[model samples]
Target: MPRKRACDSCHEKKISCDGGSPRCDWCNHRNLDCTYHRASASSRKRPQPAEFSLQDEIEQRLERLESLLQGLRRTDRGDPSPPAEISDKLPSKSQPPSHGGIFYGSLYFAGCHLGDISSRNGIPIFSDEGRRWVQDRTGEAAALEGGQELSDIDLDFAQNKLSDLALLGGHNSAPPLPTKATAQRCLDIFRASTLQVVFPVVDLSTFQEIIDRAYEETTESTRAMVCVLSFVSFLSLLEPQKTAELLPDVEMYATKAQQLLLLTMAEPTIEGLQAALLLCLYLDFSGQLQAASMLHSLASRSLFMLGGHLKPKPPSGATPDDARLRHLRTLFWLCYFCDKHISLRTGQPHAIADDQCDLALCDDYTGLDFIDLKMDGPSLAQYLPKPLQPSDLGLTIIKSKVFSLLFTPSALKKSDTEILHTVRMLDEELERWRMSVPPSVRPSLSSVSDPADPSLQHEFGMLLIFVRFEYLYLLSAIHRACGRCQAWSVDGGVPNAVRSSLLLSVEASRSTLIYLKVASEMVHRESFWLVIFYPLWASVTLFCNIIYKPSARHAQSDVELVSAVPSLLKKLRARVPTPSEALHLQRLEAFIAELIHLANKAIYKHRPENPTAQDKE
Candidate 1:
């Protein structure tokens, strides 16, 4: 006779099965119900087998009844009631097979039918019903034969049920909210340590007012603000080894804050939107990109619905009031900044485009100067950077506009000449922006001499470093766009024009590397919130140039710039203690290591270790 076939599960998985009776080894190993189809003479075109022995016949009948009971218990629990009365369908042990021992075959057929019915009704074989079904069937099976099989069935049922029950309970429940005094402490920590650097959109006094008001009423918006405050406190705890002890409380507050955020997502308001953006920043810092993307999109939609992108209309007859406009304008620019930053990282189109937005630029806020107002009276000089200065806001808009101009669908169709022209216009405008930088904010060449030392010579704050850094990045972006399109020229290899464009890119990348070298050493460093991408990608571009244009005039400088990146990143990584920062640094370090190996093999093989030649052309 032909051997028995594998079980359905094994066949589906395309694996070999031992083809054991009642249960195959493959499914058994995985705690899955091993089922085998009884071969029929007609289907296989084979001769019928001789009659089974009396003992074999009795075992087969018991197995069939057990399978039937298992099927009944597999029905969907949501079916309003438990499985039908299966015990009534089983035959008694005292009764022997009637009709020449055909009873075993009949039981097997009934089991197959019940299993198919239960599966079609959307029931899982391993659910609660299956557990109860096994219990009932095992008792009945035990009466017929008490031995190894009965004990095995009972053991498997107990083990599986315990595992299932463990999954149903929330064993790792969250900690309770911080006490009022604890919350005040967390808030104080945030205000004293983080608010200035983080540039929280919520004003200090306004935030304190919200915290006080939050205790009075449990509004969704207020709760969201509380969560935001908690996250700010959490960020503050990320640095300084001494603060490590307080991290657990920070984590608890952060979790509670997220739970409250989810509750307020249904009915979003300006306060809620602000809170959501802050949460997005926190998530981005934590390397939770998927969650951050969702909140970023949410904040974008809420801002648009509130007409944040449009210029505010003045009262019909009243004096043109622009006091509150300053705050609203600040909110709008922050949203735009976030949209552009996320868009570049994700390669997704931004929600708000240059054409659709009519809001005033950050540069326009200079005359009004309402943003300079401090929490304690009019101490404008202290808040000079004013969370985000007019210049910084202008630079952010410039980056946003550049991204729009480069990534739009139609950009690919433009000719190389058109792209070059666009680059020229942007470069000229960028030059003007550089000239307009306040004398106090610009760093002297001497400031960057000792790459390891932080810059203390300048009175300017983080805003200056941010603007300078972004300017270099934008120049790199423009040239990168120009160089990418020059590939379609259909000319000789590495044409001078293409080489020149690529050279501009190398120079821009060099500046970016130098800025990062010094800026990474600043007292209040730029947040690693997507700001890290500029140096990371700029290094990649420089590496590609060293390999592809080894003969270019600036080849030595390019290699030097690329070689310095790993050390620069290490210094920067030492400043931030977050896991996300560490992960990014590890990957970047690996990338630079590979690039160095490749550079040694390709360019350094023929060149001297210390070449005196400089790129004069």
Candidate 2:
């Protein structure tokens, strides 16, 4: 090594070394990732170039050639590398950058440069014009007195500039591109030599590193975005113990976000908070649910100046930045937790604000615009009351009931017999619901512009959303269940199907797992019924043997009786009638009481030894 460097990112990229500090010169220089601390507790070993031995060079060259050849072969063969690979030599880099002694490649791009090297390695070379554009940016940075360490003010200025640029780019057509013929004329040199290339702007290590650095440097206003994204990127992994270790940083960020909310632009702060939320969701996706949920809870309770909840603070000097907008959209994204928001949640729907919807803070957020809000966060609509017209209330009831049935008696589509029964019951329930809408009061079936417009037929439209979720579940289950090696026959086990090329990828356990995941829906049918159902389903697992045999545990009559409560409640609550119509809740409650008693008595009389069985859990 010529000399030791401060930041790993700088060293790793073989960029010009600057004074070793918390941030490196290159990172400070380029506003690129500059998070690496100089390795501590170890001294930089000085390199005294041992005389270049031919064998060493040969060995290195051979190794590089082998790697490149393998990659090329793989590409041609259409066999992608395993995602688990920690580091594969990028196919786009013709040669490694020279620290002191790597030949890498001597490419011709007027002369060899990073871009040239990239092109040599099969990475797409930006057009010469692109290079010119990049150089212009670098030149502008250079003129800024090599500003490496940015203050919050500097960051704001830079962010504004970038937003302006992005807006400009989005709106203006690239100052008319030179004709392809003319554009091609400038660089006829490497037209045939297809060697230079560069890797993707984001790779696993770099992406992770950006997050790591951002976390280290963030203010409260910026913390949430990083927190949410970190989690989102890491979730649903096979085993995520290592990934979850990243949570402490997120917590730190969350604290900062809270402060930002109280002290600065509430909207920007909220955006970062939203990002933090996404990180929580990713944690869930990766199977670290407890931790994800805990984070969510913290966010909801914390002072992140949540617009939906907070009484507006008096207007301050903080102006909104485009980054804030990006962050808001991002929060909307993170709120998507598998089917819900990953953001820190209060374990409740966002409370609809009591007075005027806070317009100064909020950019008109329609409930419909956030249809997926349920996935990433609470439905903003639910937090606020919808226009409580009779039609609106009726629609809400109808949709809720539809879901109760779809979720009930277990979402077991494997049995066509059960599915048909469920559908028939659903049809009858709908007819009942329709009947409740008396002929005199029912809206006319006139020329409707589009069935997709939920705002018009709000109740019926919302019901469609529930229907879609069920449909998605069904399709995904069917797809997963199609694994020939794991196909379900009448026996409820995998049966062989004619193997197809894609059959190897079918995930049999996926459908079963989905059913298992939403299993509580089968019992209590609340949105969170799955949380309760998990324990019950797990009871059928070997781990449950610590207490009782799975077969015996699941077979208990009490379990069946309890599971029925959700559906019964769903049936009762889903069809909320107007106060005028008088939903005799007392009668419904009494019926439930009778059912529970019968179920309990049946359970009390149940004998495990009896061969006859009627329990349908």
Candidate 3:
């Protein structure tokens, strides 16, 4: 899909967009990056109709201003810029309505329905109704199935007290409250409750039904239904071509939604929360970070992260702040996810898969097969957890079960069965955790630590990372067994010593970087600088050989860097080989470069004969 703003190349040029993808036409032919960003001022200018050009928009505005100037020249003529005339002609929208108030630029005003709640009936209206509705209907809605119980909690005023917030670096923006440390850190929350409302859309035919409903809803029930439906409706509206058309309305409603959520923050339920969550999701898709600040605030809490594992008790005598805790946890996970996205974008602070990586590794052939990985049977078994059927169970309490997989899983069967086994066990363990906890308790759970605990989102993250390594290892081992310098498989490939050399390099770079990062953490900062320099130097060697040479070839530079490609292939032949049902050697990421340089340096430079030389000290 075409991205927001412009192509990467256009962004670097610091110019406006004709809004093309792949690369703007100008940059495409020139062979440049194409990741354009939106300028804040661009929004103030009205979106020109499809046929109208940006240049035309500016000219139109200018012409109007020029006409006003001429009228002023007549001295007695009326004021220009018909805002005053429009204001007069417009009916008084000046209803003395008491707005819920604005926090973070959102305008919070509840109109019409509150039903009996607005009149203050005994039936726990307002927050209660919304929460109940969300709990009651979420699962039946397409894309929102797997809904759990309503988890409204009494506000934890003592814990959420201003003093408490300050100690924890409370929401700075809120007092004005607070934050983005990772994954698309900026939240672009908005309310799509109106413009794009529709019934749940698992398919296409119903999609239009939703849009029609949003435009036609006259009552609260239908409006509520429309709100839920619009959550999906907006996804369609977000297509690249249609995005510009809806951007203004989406922005406005997003602002409105944020205001509504913030103003009604006390005991908010699934409807408002989901609205906020969907808005954040939409903003993320559209790359709208600035206006989505409310997401950062709500998601920062602990509830959203841990609530999936929690279950709520009856309405009367439960913990008051549990729901809020759940809300925060969800935000935390989403933010953390985006954090990784940002980190990858920068391509800095790289981490090679460590020993903790998921099973599926067979170090013998990391390069030629799975990538750069080493799989061991016992290691693959570690992550396996007993499968638990889906339900609300405390993922934190299942520590022992988590440990079960840590010990070699006899049940492990696949060649790289350990990862699969671990996941099976985790299924139950995760379910157990999900079933026991209530949403309100998520924040408290965040403080708890258990390797098996569902609260430790890292457990899952680490699992995925491990899986990547396992595959890398498997791929490399196959390459080594078959023959180096071939694709994954070639009917009669034979192991080439030179090809193995390159494979070894990929491994060495990563292993050493990990060792270095760990080692540096252990030493005095000043002394550690020396250790850090080696990894950098090693990385430079690889870069000079691979990345720099490749770039030079593309740039037609004097360095003649492309010359190194042959050596790289030769080195690859000596390092590892592909061996199996046929063979092949897919490409590798830059981290592999570091591995090769470090491996070759440690092996060939200091002790050329020690082909299997390892850093044992």
Candidate 4:
């Protein structure tokens, strides 16, 4: 009377069955035998209470067996045997303790079971013998049972040597602070540089006072302040005017800054936050992206801890000119900007979630007016652009919105229609932001010749170049979603909307390369590090497009554009001060060269004139 249940094969596989007479859909598709065993009414009525108990017993036995197998495997591979005292306490292989787990701000063992692997407050509690065994394996002494806190564990054990090298700059001792006059000159140079225009993190007056105190009372100088000074000097040396004589000092300052980072990190303060962020930037500029990323996470957490993400509440009597409040707000926005940009560039989740922070832009973010101290032959202001009003911070806010609307995990899962709607909305927002920029620096969708006015170009040229690159980068990122959604339909007929997006993405990549070539002529050596990610991202986009549609009308041109990336990198490499600094560029150039070769090969294979051997046969 009732419909037959799923076939035995489907039931065993835990899949739905069509319950066909001869065979179920799954069984028929797989060409496997299908059978149904009808139960008698008496058999169905009988309860099977022991079934769950039997399953639990089997799982427990399997876990023990798996643990034994892991131990045996380790033994065969010549790893030391577990100590006698805790031999029976070893966890199942599937649930082995993680050595690098962080709980709250302290190190702890993760995935350790209570009875099998005893733990207190998420930190494993090991017997003395077990601790010794862990120490021997991990190369760091383990926490004592019950007596030691997670903080007592050596966190350095979790990090690899590469991280150590990045943090310490391969040096053992701190270098002496540069002479007071030299430090002052470097600081002056920093204020006039494009680095200040782009970042605006440091407060000059406050930092100057710190410098004076460091020199006056040398013993009392904070590690954080020293770290900041070293970084400032390091970045200043990277400016275009730097000579070969100063190259050694550049490396020395960077090394000194990095070596002090650990000491600075031990105590969290606003100065410490600033020092950490400067070090993060240094790491990024030096092409240690992974190290920079790791430091960024720590710096971001530090920002949150210091309440830098929130709008500062001045103590009841505090005035509008309160330097501390202004500094806090400035640092907060800087962190926000760095978080969004890094996430976009690295394809990692942003440390600052838009929903969690007050996204209001402050007027004080522009800080003090740039002063041209004529320490060198000519003031840097005579050559570099005056800082733009509204600054790059406005663009950063737009980037935040872009990441939230287009790139978030939930946003990626949207339907084609939803994605199209979001893309249009974002395009409108981006266009409005671009329009707000001063006409001289406003980025255009199409590639154009250099600005006609040399003065305006000199004043705002770098701004215009970077804005254009970012505009195209964002355009590609937004349209790439539509391109991906339509990629699956390439064999079928692609919708008109998706086809347009794919074309737009390719065009954006083309425009990026064109603009980069133009910008290379005007941009300084110091800014070369900034352009590395752009060309790589753009070239890869073009490479993918050519491969996807090798027979398209523009495919030939796209291949040529992809081919040009390596040369562009070579030209940009010359701008960097040292070979070590250009390592990322070298790697990127080689990778793009390979991509070009593959793309050319793909085009040749797909040409209508070319026939496969099978076609000839």
- Which 10-residue window in model 3 sums to the lowest lDDT? 103-112
lDDT of 1: 0.49
All candidates: TM-score: 0.61, 0.24, 0.24, 0.65
Q: Report the alpha-carbon TM-score of model 3 versus the true structure.
A: 0.24
Which regions of candidate 3 fall more than 4 Å away from where they truly are? 1-237, 240-248, 289-297, 300-306, 309-617
Q: Say which candidate scores most in lDDT.
A: 4
For TM-score, the strongest prediction is: 4
What range of 10 consecutive residues in model 1 has the weakest lDDT sum? 114-123
lDDT of each: 0.49, 0.29, 0.28, 0.55
**Per-residue error (Å), model 2, residue 461:** 23
Residue lDDT tens for model 3, 1-617: 22235343333222234556555674555444444353333456643212212133223423433443343335423322223322332112222212221111000011111111111001112122222222221211111111111112112322333343344342222211111111011111112211111111111223233334334425422323323332532343333233343343343343333434453334444443444555655544332332234353463232333342233332353443553443333333334333222222111111211122212211231111121122323223232221111111122123223323321122111111232223334433443433333342221212222333332222122222222222222222221211111111111111222223233333333333332332222222211111222343234233322221122121222112222332333332321221210011111213233234333332232232443322110
Decide which is better by TM-score, 1 or 3: 1
> Which residue runs does candidate 1 get wrong by more than 4 Å?
1-175, 185-198, 217-247, 314-326, 362-364, 367-386, 389-391, 442-460, 486-488, 492-498, 523-526, 551-557, 574-583, 605-617
Q: Give the residue spans of candidate 4 off by over 4 A.
A: 1-175, 216-219, 240-247, 313-321, 363-391, 451-456, 490-492, 575-583, 613-617
